[model samples]
Target: MIRIRLGARGLGGVRFAVSPMGSAKDLLRLVGFNPGTLTPSWRSRATDALTRHRLGLLAVVGGGGPLGYAPDFLRPEPPAFLTDIDTALHQIATTPQERIRYELAEAVNGHSWDPGSGHPAPRQLLQALGRGEDHFARRLADEMARFWHAALKPSWPAIRTRLEADVTARASDITQYGLAEALNRLAPNLEWRDGELLVHLRTDSIHRLTLDAEAVILTPSVFVDRALFCAGEPPGTPAPRTPLIVYPAAKVDCLPPAQDPLIGATRRKLLAELSQPRSTTEIAKRLYLSPATVSYHLQILHRAGLVTRARRSRHVLYQRLGGMV
Candidate 1:
């Protein structure tokens, strides 16, 4: 449990931010298959994506545990709303060597109060960084780049749209429901009580913090189903003015492809089947649609620019177009 005592100014100090680095880190966690803290539905969806990509560094970066901690350098303060991947990567590359070592130590060393198991992969990687092995650091950075392009960039437009919608919803909540209500609705385990905000963390340990003047930055995330609380400063120290709280967005579905209600059921089924390349007979067999009906729907899908066809040894396979979703 985490308790944050808020001063008089806390109510008006709340702010909303969209964090690109945070989202990337969250997706890295999903790639590592560490969805123990996520909702069942999200876990299933994330697991499917991870299996499809099979990123090698995901398991390594996950640190061989459910609590895989990506080095903090990867998550800088949220940059501009449209911060590019290269800019974020450059910031990470130039992180002060000392800061990298310090954050890595904190992540690897078990918290003084809680003796929960720690992650080894990060520990080893930290050692490499400690030795000033810039090569290893560069390698990890490359993996981050690859992971973002393959796993995230493809669905980023949809994710960004959902994030914007969430921000709009939060703004409405603050106006209509008031600040306290908005804070409470941030997560199931959060509550805004008299002069304080309470966060019931999944862990058994309880921690207390205070936010004197800095407003809390509330970042809505598509991947973080559970609330993630980060103290601006180390634990047990004087509380910083601004702390960050990242929680799952209200809409659980990250990327529901643009669907046309006017399109017939068979076309919808064909579009769904064509998410991956499939032959007409294969789609028909799986969807229980006749081959002729499948063919008609495929032709319609092709005409609408929703799908494309390519010849594959004695068969013409169809797949959803790149930009349609």
Candidate 2:
């Protein structure tokens, strides 16, 4: 559990940010390589696209075993409305070379994976950065570009809309219920009491942070559901800790869409099966229906917005929408 002590000025500095870069990293986890802590609703068609294109960086980015660490350079503060991928890449490319060297050195030296064991692709990439080669920096940016183009860009509109809705809802909560109430509503295991914000984590470790005047960026993420992820300053950094808390947004309009009169019994069963996201293959096997038939019905449901579809890891999955019983 971690507790943050907020000073008089802390609440004033608290703000919400939408990070495109952060979303990209979260999306990477949803890909087939390493799902980390995400419970993806559907199989990852995005990952399949990445694999089919032979984007080898997927291994490096997600490759340090299950609890692997993506480089800190990928974690940038949110830029406003970040519509251009080139702009985000430019920010990464222009990171102070000294900071890059410092962060990469730390990652290689104290990575969770065994330092003396077999080197993974993430380690290899870190080693490249440690060698004072700026090419790998660009290489990282290029990989983000490819992943964004192939996987994220197509569904960005819907994702952005969901994020916007969450923001609006939270904003309303703050206005009506106050900051602490709004914060508590974000997750079940969080609370604000007597100037401290408490977070219940899964680990036995405890942390107490006091934000005097530094701003706390509370970010809403679609992929992170169960708990909160806090990104803080690395050891030996020259700057003050700028903490970013990424938490799963409260789903609002996930109710099942209106029913159609023409829908048949088999399709209804498929809809019920999609209470959570399920891939066509999984649904077919469960219902003893042919994959083709399931796919056809899913397409119809998706067209009506009665079901929502997303790609997770290597499978395309679907779920009922609009609060269906």
Candidate 3:
């Protein structure tokens, strides 16, 4: 069933009230960057969105630079020396496994809806709940973390008390695994020692680093820089909104070859349009439907492992999942 649950959500500045599910790579192109090159800035933004919301995109494309300066929520509590920000970004960039663990913990703690493909089905929730602890694999943490965040409220106040408790429990779990302490301790130091002006990171550790630059990010979310909290405090600290996407299952083709009309028609259109790589509105106009309807179709196609979806400014773009056919 389609749903809208929020606490942390994102779509660049749009605050994505709705996100249609699809393969992560497809999501990359739709968001605005060419997947072929996989730009660091775009990856940073998409990862930030995913980190906060965990909509199931395999990866995200660049929409633009992060909004304003890094917000306070992303900064460490009470702040520290400017070197700390550099340190955090450096470590994150250097260690992908830590980031993956962090993301995985988030997926387990926050949103872990089972579209019911493989392990950890919704039925397993009860069993998982009864279990004492959540295990996180550093290798898988990056993508898993994005998925986990899906469970959180888009903002703090809107969050359920129990979820808040879950956040604490998860935090404990993270401490057990070392993500929290690592970020607080090791990460910031990395940037400081590296002597880089900006540190860029991705899932599975950092993909890039730049010294003699400006601004750095530990997670892809550009909104929060470790440096900000050290510089000063922020007001209100608006949390990033949560993002969600729903799609019918019959459409995706992850395991083996499969076909369904609802899935096939939509998939065909996505492939045809990829050459030009049109935006959501353009696809809707071409498909002759409302933007919302077009989005829903894309969502289903996405979940079924067919097409990809992305947000560019106010638009939600779509691309063929892959194989060019």
Q: Model 1 compared with the native: what TM-score?
A: 0.64
Compared with the true structure, what per-residue lDDT tens digits does model 2 show for residues 1-325? Answer: 6666678777777888776667777666555334544343323545565687666654455333433445556656665534356777776666666656665554465442446667533545656565564776676777777777776676566566556656777887888899989988877777788887777775643444444334577877776664554545534564324666777765534312222353567777886787787999999999998999999988977765456787889999787642211
- For every candidate, C-alpha RMSD to the true structure in Å: 7.2, 6.9, 21.9
Candidate 3 Cα deviation (angstroms), residue 8: 52
Q: What's the TM-score of each model vs. the native?
A: 0.64, 0.70, 0.24
Q: On a 0 to 1 TM-score scale, where does candidate 3 land against the true structure?
A: 0.24
Ordered by TM-score, highest first, the candidates read 2, 1, 3
* C-alpha root-mean-square deviation, candidate 3: 21.9
- What is the C-alpha RMSD, rounded to one decimal, of candidate 2? 6.9
Candidate 1 local lDDT, 1-325, one digit each (tens):
5666777676666777776666777766664546465544345555554466664544355322344445555665554555667877776666666555565565556431113544343444545555583555565666667666655675566566557657777777778888889888889988889877777776654445444434577787777667877645544443122566788776422223333343455666666666568999999899987899889888876665456677989999987643222
Top lDDT hit: 2
Better of 1 and 2 by lDDT: 2
